[model samples]
Target: MGKLIISVNTKEMILKSYEMGADEVVISLNQCSFNGLKKISLEELDSNIPVSIFFNCCIFPEQIDEYHSLFEKIQSLKIQSIYFQDPIIILWAREFNCLEKCIYRPETLVTNQMDANWWYSRGLKSVSISPLITLEETLHMIRNVPNSECVIHGHLMMSYSKRYLVSAFTNHNDLPSLRNNYDLTIQEEKRDGHMPIYEDENGTLIYTDFVLESFNELPILMKKGISRVFVNGEFLKDEELLDALSIYKQIMEEKDVQNQIVSFFEKYKETSYSKGYYEEKTIQ
Candidate 1:
């Protein structure tokens, strides 16, 4: 069976996930990963479950030396894998001789088996199946790629920019800067729901209006030989996130697949959960 990997940012969340029977927990490296998720030091990652470090920022020339130092420090730690998006990480992973410990997660890029195999052939541990692809495309990659991973649940990131768009807007308006505000959100001119938007030192991130739920698809993914499944805990209340973790864990353990999915759907019927692009084709 594929292992369950849940991204977490706190020591408390780590312990809670461990107690809830999660196979592994993901934590982003301080100042190194993207998204508005809280970052942590390697020291705070002490826990029973295996931890994967998210080193996902696009590297700049000036930050090369700092990245090198951080990579050196990570070598001594007990990390299951490193989820990276930047090609700069590829160089550092090779230099550190830890190519086998890396997982390429370029968000929306790994859409075909050809590209997925290319990265796996280059020695990455695995590559995340892009969330924007259809289920058939996802299953194809899982069957062909040796150790593919996918995100089963969470708010999907719609866009990420290196420019501080939120701060730029605020500054231009001469209003109080809400650059670091996590509670800030935005709505499109024609869109119905308010999407969460935040700006930090890394950049600004915009997420989808609805969270993506894959309860109905998880069983099929497991049967298709997927290596790992991720449940992102971002933008969720603690109890809600924990409940999700518990339900997915239950679905993995229980024999009645249909019943489990139905129950899971009924539980979160109120919340805006979608299959996203999993069922629909982007073209035609």
Candidate 2:
């Protein structure tokens, strides 16, 4: 059977995921500041299920100590593994002598043998398959490297950048700063004698007809030997989450592999949609 890895914030989602047939749950500490880490304790995550924690934020060199502390706490939970994206974090994972417990680059796919070899040299055991790749591309890459694990299900983050897109908008408007909540917000700007330009949270300027929906590409993903899928809870609202979870659960329970894949793609076409970068193919 294919695996499901759900990214969660609160404990409620963690418990709900198990009930929804999730194979694993990863707690994303993306927005938590250094001070916020004090609130989460190792005892809180001591559950029977397989849980992994991930530092999804952009890490700088100055934050090494905090990262180390976070890794130490994660180790204490006896979780299966933890994931990091930043190169510095990967280096730190190796420096701390905890490379065995870490997974690298969750949202990007490795297309060539050189990329795969580079990750292996860095002590990376698993890498995420990029959502942008077609199902055919994913299969070819996976077949090339049969030993590496792949994240099969989850919100495909369109982009990752250090710039705070939200802050730029508010600053331009002379308004108070907004908290980083991970929701998609639009920013409008009126140029001299021109129409107002809109920007999303990632600072990617949006056109009027830009697409902004998630896609259901799981059926194609499953056939590619994708054992684990990481769903981003921070991106979906409550209703969206329920809808996605239901669709995912339905996909997982079906016994007929070929038939299920067909059904999944059909239902996914209705549920998953993408806009901006994923749709436009424009990075910035």
List model 2 lDDT by residue over 1-284, tens digit each: 66666666666677787787776676745332211111234466655656777665565667667766766666546576666666666766666667766666545555554676577566665666554554555566666653445544334444444565656767999988664433343434643211112232323321222223323455554665555555555444444554555566666564434564455456556444343233333233
lDDT of 1 by residue, 164-258 (tens): 99889989999888876768778889988778897888899988878888877888999898899998876766667777787778778855556
Report the poorest 10 consecutive residues by lDDT, candidate 1: 254-263
- Identify the candidate with maximal lDDT: 1
Off by over 4 Å in 1: 47-49, 257-270
For all predicted structures, in order, the TM-scores are 0.93, 0.68
Superposed on all Cα atoms, the candidates' RMSDs to the truth, in angstroms, are 2.0, 6.5
**Worst 10-residue stretch by lDDT in candidate 2?**
31-40
Pairs clashing within candidate 1: none
Candidate 2 lDDT score at position 125: 53
Record all residue pairs in model 2 with backbone atoms less than 3 Å apart, i.e. clashing.
152-228, 153-229, 211-275, 213-273, 213-274, 214-272, 214-273, 215-272
What do the candidate models score in CA lDDT, each in turn?
0.83, 0.53
